[model samples]
Target chain A: MEQSGDRVTLGLDEVFAIAKSVLVAAGLPERQAEPVARVITEGQRDECHSHGLFRLPGCVQTINHPRFNRAAVPVVENTTPAVTKVDAGFGYSLPALEAAMPLFVEKARTVGISVLAINNCFHFSALWPEIEMLTAKGLVAIAMTPSHSWVAPAGGSRGALGTNPIAFGWPRAGQDPYVFDFATSAIARGDISLHKMAGKPLQPGWAIDADGNPTTDAAAALDGAMLTFGGHKGSALSTMIELLAGPLIADMTSLESMDFDDGVKAAPAHGEILIAFDPAILGGGVRDNQASSERLFSAIVDQGARLPSVRRYEARARSLAHGVQIPRHLYDQVMSLPRAG
Target chain B: MEQSGDRVTLGLDEVFAIAKSVLVAAGLPERQAEPVARVITEGQRDECHSHGLFRLPGCVQTINHPRFNRAAVPVVENTTPAVTKVDAGFGYSLPALEAAMPLFVEKARTVGISVLAINNCFHFSALWPEIEMLTAKGLVAIAMTPSHSWVAPAGGSRGALGTNPIAFGWPRAGQDPYVFDFATSAIARGDISLHKMAGKPLQPGWAIDADGNPTTDAAAALDGAMLTFGGHKGSALSTMIELLAGPLIADMTSLESMDFDDGVKAAPAHGEILIAFDPAILGGGVRDNQASSERLFSAIVDQGARLPSVRRYEARARSLAHGVQIPRHLYDQVMSLPRAG
Candidate 1:
């Protein structure tokens, strides 16, 4: 972070330690607290501001809730040769997804592909970390998670889908995997909130106003529904994700999950889908798979393009040297939080 | 059939017969000719004019090539409990995909999910028909295929990605499945061609001209590369597709496939990825899956929006009665072709 004015940078270790302390104080298990911290750490490390330290309070809101089932542990509800369904037991997605990844990787290596469906978790972090974890192990991974409704279907007036993020990762030879994660919306709600704070005008088609008219006023658009990217095509992909991560996993849609939330400021029960394929087995073998990926990426990169993981990796390296900058006000809030005994 | 000004209407059967005759006269086998005919018939029936008779000539250009393997059959190279790879033997994708769908559906039912990688074929049909077959059988499907390079990456000057269409299907009990298919580019090339033909100005950011500057002039944009919808996010999705449908199946990317085409007006050996998930098992069962889907559709439809397949089904009903209307010159061309034995 450039240290000109209100910015204060802290070492990643300091940030992770503080986040872990906050999670424990919020009544999460020590084992569970660590992954959440890493999510926040990597978010800050990789410049994912909306998901990092700034969002800790929201995470705490759910973890500190009396009915949040803090002691629940995820379990594999069913298993096939290549598919597994995990009941998140109304916990957090990170621990559940983390536990499921190894199982998925093992199964994928055996059968060439594997799928893990995790339901009942409140996922509050960036998804690239999860997909990247698998891709780093030389596998191709696709993961999707649903959220409470925030986006309207194309040509529809109501907010009927989540910001519904989907991520994909491909393994590259001796280099970082090509990983990209994005919500299927024209813009994320957080970005809209920032624009509203800055009193900035929004772009056309990014959102619609109260009467369902397209608007460039950030505040009005925020009051309404976010639009899907690519018009009908993005809406179609989002709906597919709505089913795949929700009912297909015996969980619920964003609307259903919201109903179960009962208006509480807490984590709502939700669902996620993770599919991993061992490219070595799915393609020829390790060498052959690597060549195909490297061939594609080298061509793209030569033309001065940046794949998803590449940019994140660059930010990651920068932060490794300069540390993460937390806003002074947010840092004060972290300092004020009760520490774990 | 109704005779209207500037149009010639024929029964659906008549349209299919003509398409089949044309393909067979180009020396395609009867079995192979039938699927291509049905594709054109459905295109006309559903008013998908671009993919209908307008595309038939392109299909014929490939089919009539001296080196085209019209008699080749699709062969499954390997089958795991949940995955299968089919080599199309340098033939057409319609028959190869047709031959593999049963295997995929059966495997998905057994293991809850299955994937069929169909490669070495030239796929030229709209994807819905294939996914519709699965949804008709109560399966949810996702299929993606790569094409000749036509889309440029975000912030890049040259076209390095295909229009790369993807399709998704969800089963709806007692109704046509919810299916939608779309290309990842900001606009399809055919639409660009139409714009160029009509001398229309395009909406800004639809494409970029030489030197990578954004352009709205339809003719110049047609001479340039189409942009990915919503910028980098869509570009990422398109790139993910390029690898999955291209290199993963031991097939070539758009550029590679073009190189092997050797300037012939023939179909390139392309690849596709097809995944089938039996929601009946993936969900609680068929009823539970139906309830969730119906819940989603009901809410969206009440808002006066129709999912993709519903409109197609309506057109299908109309065409069944009114027949498909073939344009005058196109009908004349079809009439001029020699009839098959």
Candidate 2:
């Protein structure tokens, strides 16, 4: 691994090996470590930094906790042609989500739609990758997940909600799929951490201190609650996700017992709900749908329209063409970590 | 009708009478006037000021136009257990949406989900009422509609997208259905008009002038485009709606030529798409689903959780108990319109 600033450049193989080794060092079984490692590394490859290598440390710590039943497998207690429920058995979200994807895709093919509600799963990495996978198969996919407390209610002071994230993906014709992944929070926790690391103040109105006073100090904001993205609207979206992902899926009333540090304890287990729609089931099949999408998008762009994800796609392509440029410090931090044999 | 200041206090019956009579006088057959009147009146009752009585004069003018095809009716061209497509035959959206709802509900009851896409319709009124009707039947509903030029692309200037709105409704146990309805614009067109009426400057960053420079002047903002809420994320959402409601429903793309002033000549043959889902089809049946949702919302609230639509619901209740509080000036404007019969 070569150290840049806060980023490290490693061959994909090497990155996976190191991640697996780290998980093993943290007491995960060798058998389970590889899959977890692969999932995380793939996230980095896809440029989902928040859920990529940056989350390895957290995952390792959670896996090492005796409360987390890493050896347990997901159990499907109920299923239908279009819906399924997976009990994660206190295992990480990666395995459960991985197990559900194929089932979801299969069901969608038959019924034109499918839903998978995963209960008792750990933090799944960036949801967009999973959405991307579904969209690549010409299906429209929406994934929602809730977190431990990080967001405040509309006008209240205490952090009572998570920065619940929702993602949607749509397949396009002759262009990159339109993928939208966003947190309901004004800014991501990773961005807050970064600002803190850089000794920079947060923008005003992004967060509130414990006393409910808005503040721009990154450290204080960290100790407080992140504001919702679009005020009450974003907060409402987060609340909706919590109801759908946490309570509805896990059969819990609220996330009161979900402590940020209890990555091991499964009380008030985090959940995820995914809904998939197959375009072929509609009036036209996938090809026809694609053509329609193409025509509309072309007309808009021809009429001086700009698509939201176009810039990100362009940036990603450029980064891929010239090796991902990582900051020296971040690179050094990753490189300095002990490597597995 | 009594004019109070610039406001008017017309009983619900009188308001309906005026609207129905105007549409009839404008050449719509008496039979079609009732549904159109019901839709507009419901908007006022629901506290959606902009889409309600405020739109009466404009709609009347459209109805009077010779090209409007006032007597056209929608035709259902496709049907499945859970999907339907209706060709509106170049009519108004109100009748088409009203006609599609019961069908959508019936299909969802059979298959646990249904999607109705209507093409060649005009701009529909407030979406929440339609969602409210669906949720009352113990189903989740999502509605999307595409409108004329109002919103700009993420980074570029010029209006290329509509203030496409997406509304979602979740049926809760014993609670008023959770409804989220908002335009994707940072500031809705109604807000801009209100600002102009009040002779107030809009908040900076909410809109851009025709040349694409950010401005707070209401007139400039009116000539310019509204920024998408939450920047790129909101823009992505708006684009998704356009795809789903516009071309997916086989309606004209916003980039196509159309006249905005004359709904008959400039109308883009817009449409509405609705998706209804039954909770019983998932792992748990409807009862369990409702119970789970109840528990989740309670837990979040126990921890000071505040949801996005909670206040709106409260406001609605108050409005119901007392009556909708319309601004005096707006009331006067409505009452001052030339009466028919």
Candidate 3:
């Protein structure tokens, strides 16, 4: 690792090692700690700073919570021909999703489409990693999860919705997968926190004060409610996520998840819903479908429109070539975690 | 029927009859005309004017197209355990979806989730009707379709995407189903046309002129490109629809669909993809999930936020109590069509 004026640069190996050590030291068993560490490292490698080392303190806080299970073993259930359910036993969502991925891929190929439901887990990472995993296996993937209640419905005055995110991935032949993961909320909570840290106000329309009036103050918006991305359309998507990833899977809603925090607000414990589709089984040759998509991609590029993951991929190339750079303060905070026995 | 001022009020039966007569008169067979008419009537009954009687002229135009098959028969194929494909034989999508409905419900109930693909069909109505059909059968439904390439992708300067719409439905016991169908574009094409017809300008963010600059003139936007609803997020969704409903089903993307039009620009001929989910098979009782969703509905309502379908339901109740009202010009247009022998 090398330290500069205000940032530290570390090789990918050192990044993963430090994350894993911190997780393990905080009492997460190896099975659960590894996937979480890998996901965080990938975020850093891709320069998605919000989901990178900045998330370390929250992961440690959640791991140290009384309700968290240190040695959780995710149990997978084959509930139906097209559904695979994983009960994470109150552990991290990453390991549970990792445990059920093979089943997801198998069922998708056999049934043409399948659902993988993960319940009773704490989620604090971006969904692109999991989406890319399925795309890597030559399948299309979609994933969604509800977080703590911090956003308001489109026309609502108070916080009653999570900053729910939806992610999608499509396989590309000999190229990076077409992937996008986004919060239905107008702004991600991490960005808000970053703004608050920098003493900056938010852009207009991003949020409302506690009284439901529009406000640009980051602190006020955090204490109040964040708006959805596309007004009612985004709200509808968020509500759908709450229903599909929540009640349909027999798990906690955002409100219920928030209540479970009992004010501590450690990473929200909830559920996730992931779906996989095998292009070949849908009557199209997988390679042909990929080829067809290339045309659409070309059209977008020809018009000077960049794909959603383009920047991330560019950052990934840089990180692979010259390691990752992180703010010094964030590195110090992560390094402050106490070591385990 | 009763006439007052510039409007005419007709019972639901009359509404269906008029729509069916016009379709049949334009050469659609009874089997195809029935479902199409039913969907249009439902749109009127629910006061979704864009998809109601306003769509009749376009439907007739498409039905009379040279490529349309007047005696088309939809064929359903059980492609996979959880995937059902219906080839509409270049007919209307309604009948194709109708032919596959039973299989969709059965497979979803058995497999916990399923996909229904309708290909080689012309789609010209709202997807809410189909979503509501699945919701009525106690299933959660999501549907999407690509249209003519009249919208541009985010950061793109030309027309490369469709006003792709996505719809979702969730069942609610003894009440109207929770449903929403929205175009990924900033505005629906029909609405833009309506604005043009009314000699009104569009909202600032709704579209761009031919030169790739934002414009409020409805005519310029119609001749140029429409913007997506939520900028990049909505653009991603529109692209997803293009792939999922298009190449994934061996059907046409929006641009290809437009090419097939050859400048005539009739209703889009493409494919639709619908996915169904059964809560009971996913370890939650059907009623339990419905009851759980009720709380979310209540939360939104308690805070002055209205559910997406509330206004439609209200209009439906009023229409049922006192027949639908239509503008005189629209009624005259329908009345002018020649009757089939």
Candidate 4:
């Protein structure tokens, strides 16, 4: 393999190959490794850098831990026509989530809406991929996950909540579907790490130090707490996620569990909720729904309207057409990883 | 009526009476007056000043217009085992929303999840009252509405989208539960009005001028555009609401050719969607679901957790116990309205 400094720039195929090899070398079955690798690399290819190749090293490190059940498959704990709960059996979260997607889509199609809750699953990759997958099938979806404690309750001093994130997807007529995925926290944990590495101060109102005072210092903020997005409003939503994903799923929450370390493995536990509806069920079915939506959408545009995701969609289209440019630094970081089989 | 100097501190009962009288004098039926008065007054009693008694005069003014169908009741357009759509028939929104609540609750209890879509309604009062009612029944609820265009699309210089508020309620065990309601706009439209009334400049990033230039002057901001919460993310969510509420229910959108000044005369336009889910469906059964939610809620608290909405709940509790304290200036504004009934 050719290397640029300590990093390497590889095409999508090459990146997937590298990721698959690393996961297999870390004891994931060869068959399982490829799919997981594909998911991560696709995230990078889509320009979601925080969740893509940047996370490989950490994930590899996680897989090497004795607690990870490389061979385990999730088991269905309970399911109804409208809802399903899965026990991930302490295995990787991506495969489990992938496995649940069809079941969720199918159920929603049959009944207009469906929800899937997974417990005891390890880190799932970027939420947008799953939401995109669902929306492509002409359905609306919402997904949420709770992480280890990183955020504080509104107006409080210490960390008591996760940087919980929620993602939503909607299908529009005659345009790329609108996809929105965001963390409830003012800033993502990955951004904090980036700030730390660059020795940069965070923006005001982004975080609080250990004593609960708001701080711009990256290190102090990391030692302290992340603030919720939109103040108390965001905090309330984050807490709701905890209820849905934590106790609701029979999993340990950020507050109830120890830090996410090898020896202190909490239930590969997180929660995700999805809602999907068939527009066809409404008035004249999907076609009428589409026409009405288009009319309203076009009217808004006519009235100086701008649709959400229009910019990102345009950027993505341009990147796809002209080719994405990977920074030399990020390219090098990928090459530094130990070679797989 | 007794007035104190330039202000008045009417008791909650008196405030409700004044509101009811205004609606009645404006030609609303006496029977319909109580619900309208109750919704508006509850806002003040619950500390939501923006949507409380302050809106009474405007609502009364709207009611007096020949376009408002005061005698009309919301008609059920369609109903399924798990879904229903109501045509508000250009009636006052408060009565239409109130008429649909029990139906939504009944269906939710039967099917574990139910969706109710309301169309052709004017702006309803504060969403919290509807959601609070649902939570009190041990059901999770989400309510969203699309309004007149005021917010600009992300990266755009002009107004194109409505503030488009989304509200959620989660029923918890042994707690007041959590209620979250917020406009997608970075600052509410009322805030803009309040700033103009005070002759003060708005903060940067809060709004754009008529020409789409970011401005701090309240008047310019009002003439221009409002910003969305959380930048692109909030903008995306607002767009989704438009899709869900505007077109999804066969309602005429703000984007339609109808004049907003005569919105009350428009064919039952503008849509609202409400979703209710019984937690039991996910937790195996009703008891398990309730127990699980309660357990999760308590465990998080036990582990250095702070509940969301506790502050507001506390404020409300104190207000109820000791009575709400309205500022002298605000009290004066309410007393200035012409006497009715």
Candidate 5:
């Protein structure tokens, strides 16, 4: 890593090494640490700083916590013809997903559609990585997970929902998969924290004050509740995630996850739901559907509209050749994380 | 029916009878008219006037169109273990949905999840009735369909997408199923028409002018493009629907559906995708998830946030007892429609 001014540039290999080392030193076994590190590295490569090495300290803290099982082994079960369940054993979600994904893909191909339920996992990453995995295998994928309760339901005052995210991925014939992952919250909780740290005001509809009044004060909004995007529509999607990824998987809801935090405030421990569809079976053939899908894409871009993830793919290309730049302070923090043994 | 001032009130029975009579008179066979009439009656019962008897004339027009096949019979095929395919044979979507739903539900129970694809259909009504059907069968349901291209992608100028409604339904224990059906567009096209008719200016974010500039003029927005709800997130969802329900099912995209209209402006001819999940299989038992789900509901309601579809359910109860009221002019329009021999 080369430090210049307040930033450092590191090659992708270095990023992976640093992430894996930090996770291993923190307490996660090599088996569980590898996939998590790869996901982190990919985040940096794609310029998603929020989920990159910046999150290593938080991951370490969660791993070192008493409730988190750093050495946990995920068990995958074929519960039904169209359902695959993974008991994550209180471990990080990435490794559990890695464990189940192969079988999940098989089931989807066998049945035309399938659901993957990952229970009792601590999740602190973007859902796009998981979605991309399925798309890479020529499948259509939708994934969602609930976070801690920090968002308010539309028309409600207090926080009762998470910044639940929904991600989708569609495979292309010979290009990067079409993908999008977004929080149901008006804005990410981390963005609000950044605004608070910078002493900046938030947008009007982004949040409400403690007493349920709309507020632009970042600190007040953080202390109060964030609003869902598009009002009730976003709220409904968030609630759906809470139900499908939560109790539908026999895991915790956002409220239950918050209660489980008990002031420790580690990454939210819950479950995730993902569905994959085999295009060959559902759409008859991916090659045939490709033409129709491309038309839609051209229609969007021809009118100067950008498809989602174009920026990420562009960054990925640049990073593959020239590495990624990270803030010096964030790099220093990752290096200074306390080792367990 | 009793006319009071400009409005007329009719019992639910009368609503169904009128709907069925209008369809049969327009040359739709009795078997096809029955399910379509029941759906229209339900729409009026729930006070969704846009899809109620007001739509009867559109159905008649579509049925009478040279391209439409009023007597087309839907054929259901169990394409895969997890997919049920229905060829609507250029007929209305409701009958195709009705024909396939039983097999779809059985597949969901036999496996854990199932997808129903209804193709080559003219879809004009709201999707809630179909979602409610699966919910009534004790399955969690999601349905989506592309309509006429009238909405624009988030950053684009011209119309490249449809209102593209998505609906979700979750079965509850002994209560009405939790259901929500909403268009991905900022507002429904019919609402814009209503606003234009009433000489009311639209809300700012609802639409853009023909030149792609933001506009509050209802007529200009209608001639131009409507915006998606929540900006890019909704746009992504709308795009997903286009891919899933359109090409994925070997049916028409919104633009193609509009092209088939060729300025005739009948209801969009497209395909629909519906997925059903058996809670008993996926979540172990719906009874267990019911408790967790109830708590989430309580949290939302306890915080003064209204649950989605509460108003619809309330109206449904009232309509069951006292029936529904319609504008007298609309009633007369339906009654005086030109009928075939």
Candidate 6:
């Protein structure tokens, strides 16, 4: 272990082991604990600290619910030639999505495209893993999910939208997939919290004061609301995600999500949409796609612009090599938890 | 006709009829001219003058090509139980999309979801019509397509991305569907051209100087490149659209489109994607969806934020009742064309 300032560096294996033990201790059944732990571990591996172990304690709170279905299994309610609906039993999103992608791949290869609609899931993890997984399997995947409303509309004063995020993945044959995941909010709520903690002034357009006037004060913005990523366009994206994940999938809207809550906070139980495409049918087959994709990435990187997936993909390699640095307080809190029975 | 300063207002039917005559006179087949004309007239009705008759002469230049196929028809292939592909035969997008939406809607209603991948078409119209069509049939639809690269990616100077656009539509049983269409660029490139012509200063974040520094001088910005909406997040969306509508669909990318020219210039040859969702399978069926969708729209409208589709819908109604205005010079040019023999 290496300690520097307020940060502690630990090996990938150690992080995974700790996460798994903590999840089990948090009362997740072993079968469920491993996959969820792996999702958190991968976030840490990818250096997405926001979605990594920092989010695990909240996951535990939802899991600790008396009504939480420990042995819940995803149910396939309807299967057509091209689309499938998976009822995720109101559990975490990763496992359900993991179970659904193979079916989408098979359908897409045969028909050139497929859609897997997943409902009633707590989607707390980073979106890259599912998309990256499909891209590795030689497919193009697009995913969208909603969260509880925490953003105001472009001209409005109230929080009426989730940070609602969208993700996309494109395959490059023998290389890492081109992928990106982003929240439609100008700034994330967690980021605002961090800015407040550090007493840092925020950039313009990041948030608004209680009166709906734009503000540079982090604490004031925290008490008000986050702005959409690109003004009205970001607000539109968030609205679209909410509809696709809510009424379109027969799931709860952010406004409606509060009605179902019993005070145990976790990722909102939202629906999600994932569409996959077969490379052979669309991209002139694997070889041609690989060539074009590589050229595209080269153009981006040569211009000194980072491809969305490259940074995380490279971070994964570094984590396995030199390990990840975690804030000592965050690490200490997890380590202090009792071991599983 | 009512005169309004430099423009004249004509009935919507008259606008459509004149447009149809002009397109036919420009060498489009009668079979194809009406749809294309209707698309243009709708733009005028919506007060979207940029895409209205102002764009028709360019459409004519392309349609008048010696190699232009007046009988061009979309070919559907690679159909599976779940997905279908449409090759647009290098024609305009409106007719091809008009042919494909029915099949997608039927497939989605039966299978829970379906995707229509369209290639080899010139897409220059608003995306709402197609999405509105599917949503009217009680389906959720999302559409994406790419265009000429005129926007710079984040952290880079040269233009490497299109103002790639995305459109989404959600059903509302007794009311108009909620729909939206937007360019990925911070401001439409055409808007910049108009600003230049009007001697107007550009808005901040709208564009950059050739050296990539943000600038408010419209002329300098025009000499440079447009900025992507929301910075890095917008770049990611543009990249995703490129992959989906280009390599993933065996189609020409913006860069590649620029390479293929037979003298005549118009909308670039590109591909598009549209995915439709069956509300019944996910949203607890029809009545539940209608109620929830209406509530969602109510919340948006009640908060004083405009719903994307409502304005367009009302515009269509007003155009039908009170007519639309056309600039005299543009109207004169179209009227001067000889009717098709």
TM-score ranking from best to worst? 5, 3, 1, 6, 2, 4
- Tens-digit lDDT track for model 2 on B152-200? 7777676767778888888876878878888887878778989999999
State in Å the error of residue A40, model 6.
Answer: 0.9
True contacts kept of each: 0.44, 0.23, 0.65, 0.23, 0.64, 0.65
lDDT per residue as tens, model 4, A1-341: 34555544456677788788777777787655766797777676676777677777777777765667788776764366666666666677767676777777776676666677776667647777778788889887778777877788777777777777787777765668767788888999879989999999899989999988999999999899999887766777787776666654446566543344434443234555657765555443322566666765665566565665465576556545544456677656666776666
The Cα local distance difference test for each model comes to 0.80, 0.70, 0.89, 0.71, 0.89, 0.78
Q: At residue A99, what lDDT does model 5 achieve? A: 95
Which CAPRI quality tier does the interface of model 2 achieve?
acceptable
Error of 2 at A176 (Å): 1.9
In candidate 5, the residue pairs with backbone N, CA or C atoms under 3 Å apart (3 or more residues apart, or in different chains) clash, namely none
- The residue-by-residue lDDT of candidate 3 on A57-166, one tens digit each, is 88999998889998799999888879999989999999999899888889999989999999889889899999999999989989999887888999899888899999
| Candidate 5 deviant stretches above 4 angstroms | A285-287, A339-341, B285-287, B338-341
DockQ of each: 0.50, 0.30, 0.62, 0.29, 0.62, 0.60
Stretches > 4 Å off in candidate 6: A1-7, A262-264, A284-287, B1-5, B65-67, B262-264, B284-287
After superposing candidate 2, which stretches have Cα over 4 Å from the reference? A1-8, A24-35, A76-78, A248-269, A283-341, B1-10, B65-67, B257-268, B283-341
Q: Mind giving the per-residue lDDT tens digits that candidate 5 earns over B121-177?
A: 888888988888888888888999999889999999989999999999988889988
Instruction: Indicate the residue-level lDDT of B50 in model 6.
Output: 73
Worst 10 residues of 5 chain A by lDDT: A283-292
Task: Give a tens-digit lDDT track for model 1, residues B190-241.
Answer: 7888888888888887898866788988778866788888689889999998
- Model 1 chain A: lowest-lDDT 10 consecutive positions: A284-293
Model 3 alpha-carbon drift over 4 Å, by segment: A285-287, B283-287
TM-score of chain B of each: 0.94, 0.87, 0.96, 0.87, 0.97, 0.92
RMSD of 6: 2.4
For each candidate in turn, give its C-alpha RMSD to the true structure in angstroms.
2.3, 4.0, 1.6, 4.2, 1.6, 2.4
Comparing 4 with 5 on DockQ, the higher-scoring candidate is 5
